[model samples]
Target chain A: MAARSLGVVGARVVVVAAAAALWELVTRLAAQPYFPAPSTIVPRMYELWFSGPVTHVFLTDDALDTFPPSLGRLLVGWVAASLAGIVLGLAIGRSRVLSDFLDPVIDFGRAVPPPMLVPIFFALFRIGTPTQIATIVFGVIWPVLINAVDGAATVDRQHLETAKVFGLSRPQVIGRIIVPSAMPKIVAGLRLSLSLALIMMVISELVGSTSGIGYRLMTAQQNFLITDVWGCIVLLGVLGYLLNSSFLLVENRILGWHSRARQNA
Target chain B: MLEIIDVTHTYGAYQALGGVKLTLAEGELVCVVGPSGCGKSTLLRCVAGLVQPTGGRILLDGVPVSQTPDNLAVVFQDYSRSLFPWMSAAANVALPLRRKGMDRASRRTAAMEALEQVGLAGAAGKYPWEMSGGMQQRVSIARALAYRPSLLLMDEPFGSVDAQTREDLEDLVLRVCAHHGMTIMLVTHDIDESVYLGDRVVVLSRSPGTVAGDLQVSLPSPRDQIATREHETFVRLRAEVGRLIRGNQLSPQET
Candidate 1:
């Protein structure tokens, strides 16, 4: 099992490396000024992270390190969205009355294109980063909330009865039974929400942020600096991958019993 | 002692139990035999306080059973569901004791003791789904025993297992009841089982169910399944129970 998993990890590494190489080759062959090769982007990514000049890339002549502010906003907005979505979802799913009332509203909110909300948020909040963060939070909360509610509501009736028979109170039942039972579904919802959060983060920054990877991308586009645009894209992709992988690791750890049971069966 | 007085239960418009009366003395194993949909389950549920009698009362050691009495525990038929799937067999057995204010280590110790009684000490760490149907049912039985209820109610506990497992479970119940001095009320559809397990077999009539006949078994205690089946008294009791359950249609002279 250990050897097989090692092989799988090795294959993933190879695949990622090959994909990056291909992207670099394609851009180089096309002679696209906007698409930076991996070699050019790697050094820039390292410099941006560790030693780049601290100034707005658009406003300044030199490289403006922007990874920290972008990462910080993404983390805060994503966490807020996740917590709100899960709590709301569990409440809505468990209560038929609330779910019925909120269904259409959630549906409408989810259906609206996230990018279109940027202007509305900017107008409402004036020119602050909170408006962008709010836009991302709004975009990401729906999926997590919907999934959580569905998961929590469908906890096995037999198990619930067993808990009642054992004299578990409402909170005890929810904590020890409902939440654990609903975990897989909640995890699935979180996965969806995570990706959406990343997309919303980038979109919000691209449209309005004075500083962020998205702002750097926009600046690169205006200046026709293809290498810098590619670098920003690469950085965003890496960040998104890290976010998703970390969530998966946590999910695997918490749900190890479920996976083991499945394998045994 | 447990006394059920003129119990009647209704589900919406349908009357399930009507004027059912019964009593169980301490340490007595009474089996209730009836056809499907005859409200045998309803009677058990009423006793367990899982369902309230629309009219009448169930008194356990003199107090009316409003909710599940502290000294009562139930073994339900669906063992897979009755035992929490996520918890280990020991944990499932220990679950009821959470209400008793026992600490975690004490609960674990009591659960292990119960599992040992049911011949499932080796399976303490296994999940319910990991064990066979018979073993899972034993875990459920172990759970009931761990609770140490004065009045133990089992609702068709072995209904889901095979004949071999059913017989094994029946003997296990008898042994546990004898050892622990548990007063058991077991509801089953099998006539042979009713005779095999119960000190007294109570037969119920058709829907809107009421007790038809209650007969005491004169067979010896610490009964062996194979030897007891061949015994004259066991044969006679099985025949009498079979007749009684089939609407008691035979004339008294014929019986």
Candidate 2:
């Protein structure tokens, strides 16, 4: 198993390397100002983010200005969206009356594009992290809410019956049975929302003043720092990959039983 | 004790149970048997307070069962679905005990004891998916036992396992029933199982199900899987229950 995984990793590395080489050749030959070569972009990315002293873990001051604020907004917005979506989803999923009352509104809310709401949010919050966070939350909350509703609504009938028979209180039933039963879908929703959150973060930053990677990308574009813009895009891709990988690691640990149970079934 | 007084239930236009009446004495093990779609499960659910009958009512220990009684637990047929997949065997058993107002230590102790009683002490740390069908059913039973319910309801609890495992679970139920003196109402379609595990067998008619017959089981105490099944009394009782179920099928009833 270890050898097979190592081989897979080796294959992935080779594929990425080959793709980078091809991109370098094409872009260098084209000599396009808009598309910088990977060699220059890679060096520029290092200069922007990773060339700091050892005291700051090799992060330059630019890195501090770029990553933390954007990441912090993303984290805060995602966490808020998660908590609200799950709580509301469970309520809507479990209660027929509530779902009946709120479903049309939820559908309408999720229908409007979130980036379009950024301007409205800017009007409300006046150009700060609050506006960006609202944009991310509104953009990303639908997947979590919808998936959680699907999960909680379709909880096994026998499980609920068993809970009822055992005389579990309402809170006890929700905590012990409903939440765990809904977790697999909730985690799936969270994963999709994470990527959406990243997209929203960038979109929110692009239209407003900010100290974030998205703002950096916007500034580089306006100044025609083509290499720096490429570097920022590459950094975003890397950041997204790292976030998804870490999320999957945590998901595997928590949902290990769900997959095994499905196999048994 | 449980009393079902003319319990009638309907799902839309379809009547599932039509004025079914039965009663269980404390510490008695009664098996409800009938043909497929006879609404034995519906009757059980009504008693468990999962569904409200369209007409009539069910009473447990002289109180009307508006919701699940405090001292009651149910073992469902599909153990895989009934048991929480994320929880370990011990945790599943202990989950209901939180309402019992026991401290964490006592809950753990109770869960462990119940697991040990079901011959699953070593598997306490294992999740439901980690165990075999029979073992998972055992965990389900352990969960009910840990709740220490005054009344226990089981709906086709052993229907999913192989014959050998089924026999083992039947005997396990017998042992636990005797040991705890638990008042149990078990629903199954299997005549032999009804005769083997029940102190009395209650038969329901086909769809739009109603009580057709109730017969006493007179098999010897400490029932053995092989020896008791081979007993002449067991044979006669099972045949009688089978005849009742068959007779119900012959009668005209709306699908």
Candidate 3:
């Protein structure tokens, strides 16, 4: 098992290294301003991010000012959407009347693209922190909500029967049995919603935003700082990958049984 | 005492049970045997008050059952599903105790005692999914026993396990019921199991199940698997129950 997993990690590293080498080769041959080679972009990204003057921490005031707000907004938006989606989804999923009545409205809301909704949020909340946060929350809510509904709706019949046979009350049944059974699905929804949250965070920052990584990227693009633009792109890619991997870390902890079953199968 | 009076359950136009009547004296163990597609489960559901009969009523200790009564518990087939997979064996057993408004310590003690009775005392901390089919069904039985219900309904509880485990569970049921003086109505499709475990065997007809025959079991208790099977009384009753289930009445002399 250990050898097999090591082989997998080794294979992944080889693939990533080969892709970077190919990109470096292509960019060097073309020698274009629009496409900085990987070698230039990698060191430039490090200098732009970690090159900040050492505060007590490694981060400079610039890094501190730019990175935290984007990360913080994603966290807050993802958490808020998760909480609301689970509660509302359970209620809607359990009741036929509620599910049917809200299905159309939810469908319409989700049909609107995340970036498109940013302007509406800016108009409603008047273009500030509230607007940016609202846009992220709105974008991420659908995945969590939809998955939660599906999860709660498909709870095993045997579980419900066991609950009834045990004489669990209505609230006890919902709180104990229904919620736990739906939890694996809920966590899956949260993972999808986190990525959507990142997308909305960037779009929200694109307009009427001045203090995030997204703002810095937009500024770099406007000023024709091609190297800085490439640097920001690399940083964002790293950030997105880190966010997803960290979420997986937590997801694996919580859904260990679920994944273990899948692996065994 | 439990009374299932002329219970008839229908789903749309298809009848699952038609006018089934049965009764159990307090502390009696009655095994219900029926054909493969018969309404043994439907009848058990009616007795447990999990399902309502379209026509007729069920009574447990003189109270008409519209919903599951607080003092009653059921062990269903598909033990893998009935026992909550997420909960430990002890916690699963303690589940019914939560409904009775018992304190946590008392619930835990009682649940442990139930597990002890089913010979699964060491497995208290294990989850249902971690156990084999036999052990899981034992956990399901432990859950019901922990409830301390006066009346217990078991629906094909041992059907999923292997031959050896089935015999062990059969003996466990007899001991548990006799010791606690708990009234039990066990439903199964196994004729030999019905004879071995029951003080009375109630045979059910094919579909739209109604009582075909109810015979008394006179074999002595403190029963051993080998000795019990070899006993003249056990052999006679098993054959008689077998014939009844196969749609033949007992010979006049046997009846």
Interface RMSD of each: 2.2, 1.2, 2.1
Superposed by TM-score, candidate 3 places the C-alpha of residue B114 at a distance from the truth, in angstroms, of 1.8
TM-score (C-alpha, index-matched) for candidate 3: 0.95
List DockQ for all candidates.
0.40, 0.80, 0.50
Candidate 2 lDDT over residue span A23-98, tens digit each: 9999999998888899999988898889999999999999988899999999999999999999999889998999
Candidate whose DockQ is highest: 2
DockQ agreement of candidate 2 with the native complex: 0.80
Of the true contacts between chains A and B, what fraction does model 3 have?
0.42
**For residues B71-164, what per-residue lDDT tens digits would candidate 3 score against the true structure?**
8888888987787666789988987788789999999999999999999999999877678899999998988888888999999998888999
> C-alpha displacement of A233 in model 2, angstroms?
0.9
Error of 1 at A191 (Å): 1.9
Off by over 4 Å in 2: B251-255
- Kindly list the per-residue Cα lDDT of model 1 for residues A1-265, writing each as its tens digit: 8999999999999999999889778978987655667888887756655453455433333334466667777788888988888888888888899999998999999899888988999988966579878887998887788889889898887677667656776787877788878887888888888888878877898876788778888998899877677777877787889989999899899886677667665
The local distance difference test score of model 1 is 0.84
Question: Model 3: clashing residue pairs?
Answer: none
> Where is model 2 chain B poorest over a 10-residue stretch in terms of lDDT?
B246-255
Which CAPRI level is candidate 1? Answer: acceptable
lDDT of 1 at A259: 73
